[model samples]
Target: MHALDYFNARLEATISPMDYVKAKQMSPEKYFLIDVRNGPTHVRSVTIKDANVIPEQELQSRLNEIPQDKEIIVYCWDVWCNTAAKVAKFLLEHGYKVKELTGGIAAWKEMNFPVTNSDQGNNIPDNCGC
Candidate 1:
């Protein structure tokens, strides 16, 4: 089965940042990144490469915009946030293959992964903590 069918709604399996990094390095063509934070928060925070800003609330209507055949990684602000989880649940319900980006953007930067501001894709933020 495809990655989408395995996650999002069904909760059968999920992926982590380490796995994501591995994918980024090995299979960029097979993965898709999603930033589920609200637009304003996304604008104010760091973002990952290839991640699209699709707030959790808007996911229902925008499901088609996400590819069903690729591994999707979703993330929000941090541990206290559930936006990413919610988006994952919604995707699971809608039959989209999706996984929550572990640690959200917080974990991404913690691992020293690269990120960029929404306004301009330059100066990728230091995995600097929030």
Candidate 2:
């Protein structure tokens, strides 16, 4: 497929960070958040509350761990990164509901949403603990 075609296709599968925040606030149970950044980066960076760390390279192997019932929202570093799109596409092809976070973590942070950084000793929010 042409580059534009690929870009357009991925755009259709993405959710804006603001929209995601609304969804998360209105119905947190409807979607699962996935962080597709590599381990070291993930550890150093803050992530959306309750997001699961599933780096892109390990996603396929960890497929069984993700629930099929909820929509999955994947994010990487920022808008310039396409890792989330790749993972979203893979999940969609595998029959799982998925969407990419339009601007990734950078956008999320820009919106002033809550995030937890393990390196900073911040309390990581747990879905079950909420």
Each candidate: what lDDT? 0.71, 0.78
| lDDT (Cα, tens digit) per residue for candidate 1, span 1-130 | 7878656544434566788888788877887788777644435456776678666656677787899988778888887777787887777787777777767888888888788777532333333222
- Summarize candidate 2's per-residue lDDT along 24-94 as a digit string, tens digits: 88998999999877535434367787788777777788899889999899998887777787888789899
Lowest lDDT block of 10, candidate 2:
121-130
By lDDT, the best candidate is 2
RMSD (CA, Å), each prediction: 7.6, 7.0
**Model 2 superposed RMSD (Cα):** 7.0
Off by over 4 Å in 1: 1-12, 39-43, 120-130
TM-score of 2: 0.77
Candidate 1: lDDT of 10?
A: 43
